[model samples]
Target: MTCNLAYNPRFMFLTKTIRYNLLAILACLLWSSSFVTTKHALDYQTPLTLAGLRFVLAGLIQIPLCGHLLAPLRMLRKEFFTVLLVSIFHTIFLYGTFFIGMTWVGGAEGAIMIGVGPLSSALMAHLFMHDDKMQRRTLVSIGFGMAGVVLISLASKPWSPVGLKEFFGLMLLLSGAVVSALGNVVVAKRKGGLHPIALNSAQMLLGGVVLLLIAFPFEGAANFALPPAFYGQLMWLAVISATAFAIWFHLLSKIKVSKLNLWKFLIPLSGATLSWLLLPDESPTLPSLAGMALIVAGIVIGQRESK
Candidate 1:
């Protein structure tokens, strides 16, 4: 026999909120680990090639889960164009810069750079989304987050000169974050009228094909043969992309963009922690830890004020 708890409205609401929060946290965990996995995969493949293969695999995996094979065909013209634009910003520019940037920076450092995404997204949403205007508390929280990024950058260059490669990597990462922020705003703006899975699948497939086409011309004579471990890394990265993005899109459909995106602060923390444990070269210094603390504090303040 199944047991049922008496349903109080408050309890039910709390329970639902907890579940959604847990799902968001889980998505962030998977996404954070992706930085390390992408770094590993880059050892065997160029950035564009790796990104193309990863997204193609993820897109194909999502297709069957979409239930209807012709879902894209049913979308309105406006919705189709919106999805295509999201593909360009979200997949092409975001992952292109992300993967290429990782080639120049350590996994943990790259992850820290991605910490800027939520703050930037919040600012963009304040400009574009009527319901998500930034209040005084949000402004303060953004200031804290920005300070944390500054601290992390300074910590990375305490004694030595920052090399050109490192500077370029930082720029690429910032570019990726900005493009990703724009994509988040776009998705939040176009809230209804299409299934999230279908949208993701279409974007991944289209974006993956585009990346591959570009990879062929620019990164000719690409090698596919690699160690067994490299293939494992590829598969894992693909799975992470598929699962994290699916959950993220679903959450975006249900939650306010500003409120939901505050959870992104966890990405850098998780990424740095996992990279420290998994990759010897990615251990965090003292100032980096302090910077992470500040970022976390900013997120806590933002979340409390939002509530």
Candidate 2:
């Protein structure tokens, strides 16, 4: 018994690490699915309007399921602004650019572009976190990841030199990713200052409201008289957002932001693969595969210890 207990700490550490990684992977997987779903939904709805509906519905679903809604409300008084800032970047800007950018690129390209997020997250985590520093491996990974992104951009138009439109779109998509990293840093700083459900629900609600306001003025109204496919996509997106954001907030509080984000490497892999399978117009191309390989390699490198 004594000998068994002696190694218990190591076992516990390994268990905890595995659990966290699994949770991170789960969240990233849900996120990766959005590219395909959003693509289908976009056919029936305007960009910002669809985004608004997804988040608002997500928030509505999450808040009720939270069991005690008042608890989140109570918690919000102290952490209101923190959650607000998160909503601005995480929900509004992230989805805003995501919708617009997808118009210019296919689902796979959009997902790969979003995959560039962890590179930015690594840098931001170093700036904001005491435990996460920019190491040689991190630097090396960034170089590789940038190369991957460039390759992906070149491949965006599929076997042709990417024109200014695709380049601009990719940049817009990447900007959302950068702000999203900042948002993750914000959530990490809190370290569970708010309940994950509460925080996610609040941000989604607030962000959804603002998006609807913006959409009405600029993008115009959305038609609810639509096909089952559109509604199905919207429902799935909302479900995933509610579930994934809750998981993400929980993970952000518990794990090192940089280390946890290493799992995001799965996003590009899963997203692109799914896109190729689902989206009619999308298929594997040399530059895209090569770019994904480099990005995955960078993520592998990023996972290494500083030495």
Candidate 3:
């Protein structure tokens, strides 16, 4: 017997929309896990070195699948430059500050700060993109998400007589958020025929190379030796970076950036949970749990509104 629902165009569209939304959520989850993994990797390597190596590894992993060594050569000059701009904002500035900030802040704290990216992205999209204009519901969702982040940050005591290192870390994390939001706007604004995988690979490779070059002057290449555990963490970070960026860019190509970015509210929740489970010193307090609950609620509301 044929199912009438299967033949219904509206129903089919809804199913596909849900599938794409799920993909965005999955990407958020993968990205959220990075806070913890990056924190672990930082213990064995300097921030710049770790950032450079992680993305370089990720770019190498995606090379064959994206186009081996001929991908960038195939891109038009304009497209190549667009990808380079994306690499600058998204990889070099975003992750570079992120890794450095994580050195001073805890993984959970870093996650909360990064949680601000969704609101930033939404505002940027509304301002810059015609089709991504913000609605009442989006404003409400952003309010909820930002409130949750505020609650988490307060509960985490990020501002109670902040030291120099903590203050610098907070600034860096917020800067990363802004750069990341700008990158999302750039990607959404791009009208190109380049494959998403190719774009992702080129940006990561270029950004990684830039980071390594920057690292050479300040961090140097002397302390490259690390244990087996560090290598494992490095490989895992590479997998996470490659997979998450690919999924995220593909979703950005398909959907509204505002709607897609709403899923990033889950990052703090997931990152905090993972940090609690893995790092004994990073357990969340009761208020932090309440903040996480608000974050989850905000995500749910945003998801429903997106539909």
Candidate 4:
């Protein structure tokens, strides 16, 4: 006879694990749509300027929502070094390279490239943490995840770029992913007593300011004046950053980096879907369908009870 899962301890435990996994999945989904949104926003502003402004607004919005800016401010005295490191890795380098990279590639292609992030994180974890060694399950998941990204990339998009720009852009994004993996390790390892949301806001504010500084010198003077529609997109991007990063950091603090990153394989699947749906000229091709299936299968295996 089939057992009632409600009374099964293993089933209950698995259910709880799935629930937390959903939070990270939600964050990935939000981040995936950013390719579409960021691409659109870039039409109105330079990449660096748009990225800097988005996170700055996100940081400002988050600080007040966390009940007080002062708590995060105070943590600077004690956790300033940690926060600074996070700002550099998580915000500045990660997002900086991402924005610049976006300039060279289409939304769907960029999103697919981002799918490799989990593999990168897994490698980083294996090298850095003694106990976080890659197991058979991780290798299998990585195989599926990498295959999925490859399949999706094979599907041609109308917006796909040709020539050297795309190559350079992808290289930058790859570099960003490598360093961003390190940021994940740092967040999981070095999170202090400060609340995750507070830490997220502080790091974002600092990094956003630095990005803005870099933008001014390279992209010319900033202009707050823009169409109201552009501001709407900016606000949505900010909300994505504020909410998703908070959820991500909170989960990172509790979960093992190697396993947690496995869920990021869903990013390209969701990102490509959003792009295909939202972009006027884009549509899902056969390879994309196959790719998404592989990503789903990989994530399912990743969630199994294994080290």
Compute each candidate's TM-score over C-alphas. Answer: 0.87, 0.86, 0.91, 0.91
Which segments of candidate 1 are over 4 A away from where they belong?
Answer: 1-7, 72-78, 106-109, 148-160, 280-289, 305-307
For each candidate, how many residue pairs have backbone atoms clashing (under 3 Å)? 0, 0, 0, 0
- Model 2 over residues 1-307: C-alpha lDDT tens digits? 3568446897887777779778888998898888767877888899999999999999988877677867556545777898789999899999988888888875446656766787789889998888878677777777776677667655655444578888888888989989999999999988856678988988898898889999998887768899888888999999999999999999999987776777777776676677678779878789878988887788678765443
Output the TM-score of candidate 4: 0.91
Q: For residues 47-137, what per-residue lDDT tens digits would candidate 3 score against the true structure?
A: 9988999888898888778755777545425487788888988899999998888788754466567878998898888888999998888
**Candidate number achieving the greatest lDDT relative to the actual structure:** 4
Across residues 1-307, which tens digit of lDDT does each residue of candidate 4 receive?
Answer: 9888899999888887878898998998888777668877988999888889988999888887667868667656778998898888889999999999988887546766687799899999899877688988998998898899878767745455467989888888988898989988888886455688888898998889899999998999778789998999999999999999999999887778889999888877876787677778778888889998998888888778854
Candidate 3 residue 146 C-alpha distance from true site, Å: 1.9
For all candidates in order, the CA lDDT equals: 0.78, 0.81, 0.81, 0.84
- The alpha-carbon deviation from the true structure for residue 51 of candidate 2, after best TM-score superposition, in angstroms, is 0.3
Clashing pairs in 3: none
Which sequence of candidate numbers ranks them by TM-score, best first? Answer: 4, 3, 1, 2
TM value for model 1: 0.87
lDDT of 3 at 156: 63
Task: Estimate candidate 4's RMSD in Å.
Answer: 3.0
**Candidate 3 lDDT trough over 10 residues, lowest sum:** 69-78
